[model samples]
Target: MTKAYFILILTSFVVAGCGTTQVKRGNLGKVIEPQESRLILSTKNIVSVGDVMLRAGEYSKEGIKLETETFNLKDSQTTSVKHKQHTFIFSIPSGEYLLYSQNNEGSYYASEQPFSGLKGTKDGYGGLFVPNGSPSATEFYWNWNKAPNVLFAHQAMLLTPINGSIGKTSSALKNKNASIPSATLTYAGVASAQVRFVYKEFTADGYARPAFTQEVSLDYKPGGTYAYKSALFKVYKADSTSINFEIINPLY
Candidate 1:
């Protein structure tokens, strides 16, 4: 009896203020007009060109309830900085805001729960507002994780599994005394075989533990299709010792 071994491999909330700088502005018999405060949105890492949405207040499932604006990074005015990073500048009222990011294809990549914008500096002028880190927002760093996985834009993403072990299930046997399973196409006159499947989860740092696992007995013919949970695949060949299958929806 022969056994085939098939291996398949697949892969914070903080609100702080920028230090205020005092500037002396003499108002000697002169009326000083109030200038709008600027909020600098800079990113050192981005997956692709897409719209960046910012809404007043914190993120909620029912939505912002107020006016929400989206700015496309491609169309927004940006300035080049050191290390080829881009900085997006926005003039918004002083308040808390939530940020949502999505790719051009409408796939969400990142989300920032709540950040603040201040209106005054030590100089008694419009102050520059930013996240905990100024000039570079670490929350926008999408490339932090090198693993390939889906990105959800709404809220914090859950961890996923990686380097999952392959699971096998068989239904029939030909020789009771056979020490190993056979791959000769048929077993005990049964036109069925076993196929191995794997489960995976995604994470920002790397991968997460398996969401779940269950023991199931499945029988399929050569070149047949099957579905297990959200995974769909077609069996090209299967036997007691080895099986070959193709994932129909790899991204699902």
Candidate 2:
């Protein structure tokens, strides 16, 4: 058996979000949807060598509005609609980065922590799970309670890096990257309460990277469907997440 790591090119759709502030970072710049998200790379920065860490949603649910109704306890009522919309603000100066995704084959381990989508490694359904093919402009949410080892809720997006050419990164560069030490990438938004990120690294396939969980939607949709566009949770990235990951050249 052979393992294959890949960098695939895919199309993107841009959606501009109104500028806002992130709780963790305070005031940032324009809000970026999955399309507007990109990696800022340069010949100078070593720590900035990957796509922006995907931002977690302040609100767990999207495209759902509450309809206001007045119940007279005996008669009828009137109502309005209210939906929670939040923007992800980036403070980390945009630069070189690689898009990261977990959960291919839609691996949603209710008991597995990190929900790093690595259980496939043990089950032998190919390898680490992720988007087995091209992904569309859709939002992904993880019932953190359902994601094994996860204690929070999270809304994640499937995206690509601005420049995607992470073929073989030499062990020397990986060594250098290791020496550089990893820093936490952050965005900004003030969470009301009941949310925080616990950072830890997990090894899957062959690459080792930090894994963290944030609270998103408290509600879990068990039947494999969202209220809005039914994006396939099983497939996340455009490339197959299976295959052995041999770290000949490592890029984060």
Candidate 3:
């Protein structure tokens, strides 16, 4: 049998200081020969743009053994490319594997959960007010009523057996309680496919927020075939005044 591999492309606009500033950011990483008895992994142009770092690991029932490789872009002088791509190569024994990429500062990885619930209150003078029970007027002034904001956004991919035996699902999978638009799935090859998820976010006052609807497309492929699946898409939010609770495991 031929060797199998997995590739991931993560793209986003870098936002800083309360989502005020936006900059283009991208990173690419891959794992080859995942299921082969022996494999080779390689990378290129990864450290050319923005600081780049790569990591590889083998997954098994026992545990995970990880190895890391780091490349510093800050120390090196390189021009920014409009469409720069990075590549990584590795050799390993046959089995399932995971790969990750990050910036030189050490801040990027696929995570299951990204954000946490609001834990503190706001006080007068826009300072941190430590009170309870949803910011009453006595505890906070109207100007001090600080709404939540998006701090960070993260994305990750999870692979599972296609025979429905793994019992794994997408992070943005659908549920009966939620309203979702119809989705289409495209089969790319034997082990890979794409699925798209589209939905809208409504406010507490019973109005649909403008530009609140989002579609997220994800690509899936097995170790065998090269078929392309339709893109799977989902929407996530940093904060919403109308929504009381954070949407948990949006897609189950």
Worst-scoring 10-residue span by lDDT in model 2 = 241-250
Better candidate by lDDT, 1 or 2: 1
Off by over 4 Å in 2: 1-86, 91-101, 105-130, 135-153, 156-166, 171-252
User: What lDDT does the true structure give each of the candidates?
Assistant: 0.26, 0.22, 0.21
Residue 25, model 3, lDDT:
24
lDDT (Cα, tens digit) per residue for candidate 2, span 159-178: 32111122211111112233
Q: Which residue runs does candidate 1 get wrong by more than 4 Å?
A: 1-211
Q: Give the TM-score of candidate 1.
A: 0.21
Candidate 3, lDDT over the whole model: 0.21
